[model samples]
Target: MTDASSSLSSLIWADWPAPDHVKACVSTRIGGFSPAPYDSFNMGDHVGDSPANVVKNRARFLHLCRLKRVGQWLTQVHGTQVVEAKDDGKVREGDAVYSHEANLPCVVMTADCLPVLFTDEQGSVVAAAHAGWRGLASGVLEKTVATMGVAPSSVLAWMGPAIGRHQFEVGGEVRREFVEHHPATDQAFQPDYQSRGKYYADLYELARIRLGLIGVHQVFGGGFCTWKDERFYSFRREGTTGRMASMIWIKK
Candidate 1:
């Protein structure tokens, strides 16, 4: 039995460049009721954690955030599918979700994969995206930014913790997907010696490139590495693991 009230002290929330009207946060794996790999703050339901503990953990975390309804969804096999948060509880398969309506908290879960949050200058809209390599390459950020119905120039983004470049070993095919998207992706890939057909890839840089292409230059955050930081949940670091959430919303 974990204490939900006292557990709020352990999650990590990003302090991005967005204005006060937009409320955004990313949870770490420190505050919840589970044991071992899913010890605490594991918000993912399909990751093999006990369903009851996952439920308790999510309820406890949601309560701690003081939110009644949070929009979370079924993330499909890495691709860029952006949907509306109004589709919450419907189990839509998508990599991103956004809403112009107030009080609809959009969220994405992650371990080593990147969770990116977005909002505009007016703070009338907010979005969250699950950007694993394929999603990033397939334009997940671009898709999310387009859902805002605002000028892309007015958008701001915050890249949450993810697998760092040094630890993200990718095969030639993975690198091909990015380079095929943009030849400039070469800059974000480096040779990996541990295997003959692998390279170190930087997810943040790849996202920045895609975001910049869509005119989102006011981006912030993106310096943390889930695989390297003990405070975060890293699927790559630990084979069977927990997931943390990155969320964003407009206070209604």
Candidate 2:
């Protein structure tokens, strides 16, 4: 468990040039009420963490972030579906959530999968996407940018923590899926010398390639390895573990 005194300090704020009205943060695995394995700050209720503990942790998160509304958490299916975040209190089924509304946080929970936060230069819209290998390969980021209803050039993106390149080993099929979409993606995978048919995948590079293709050139905040950094959760490292959240919102 993490120290209560360090709870507020544990959040990793996005270091980007987003507009003044745009607020974003990614929670670390510190400061909460869960026990070992899910120990301390586990934001995902869908994981094995106690629902009550997840609730308390989320409450502490909102309190620390000074957010007025509950986050719009999706039942992420590793697909390319993008939905608008509303105050309807419905748990939508999608890999991404975008919102132009104030105080309505668009959030994505991730352990090792990439969590991407988006916002327009005008700060009128903000979004969060859960980009696992499946979703990333299938165009979740593209769908998110398209849903923002703004020119892709006007959007700024931030790649949150995830499994880093060296730590993310993948099978031949995973590499083939990406290379099949864009042959250039082949460069993002390097063969694992010791393990035949296995390769190390760079999710960050793949995300940058996707965002660049969609005209979002002002991307920032990559290089965090969830597997190596214990501050965040990593399903790849611990099969049964908690999840962290990356949240973005427009200020009221």
Clashes of each: 0, 0
**Tens-digit lDDT track of model 2 for 21-40:** 89999998888889988988
lDDT of each: 0.83, 0.91
State in Å the error of residue 117, model 2: 0.2
Q: Give a tens-digit lDDT track for model 1, residues 141-163.
A: 88888877899999989989999
Give per-residue lDDT, candidate 2, residue 66: 89
Candidate 2: list runs displaced more than 4 Å: 4-6
Alpha-carbon TM-score of each model against the true structure: 0.93, 0.97
Model 2's alpha-carbon lDDT is 0.91
Best-matching candidate per TM-score: 2
Clashing pairs in 2: none
List runs of model 1 lying over 4 Å from the truth.
Answer: 1-7
Q: How many pairs of residues in model 2 come into backbone collision?
A: 0
Q: Please give the range of 10 consecutive residues that has the lowest summed lDDT in model 1.
A: 1-10
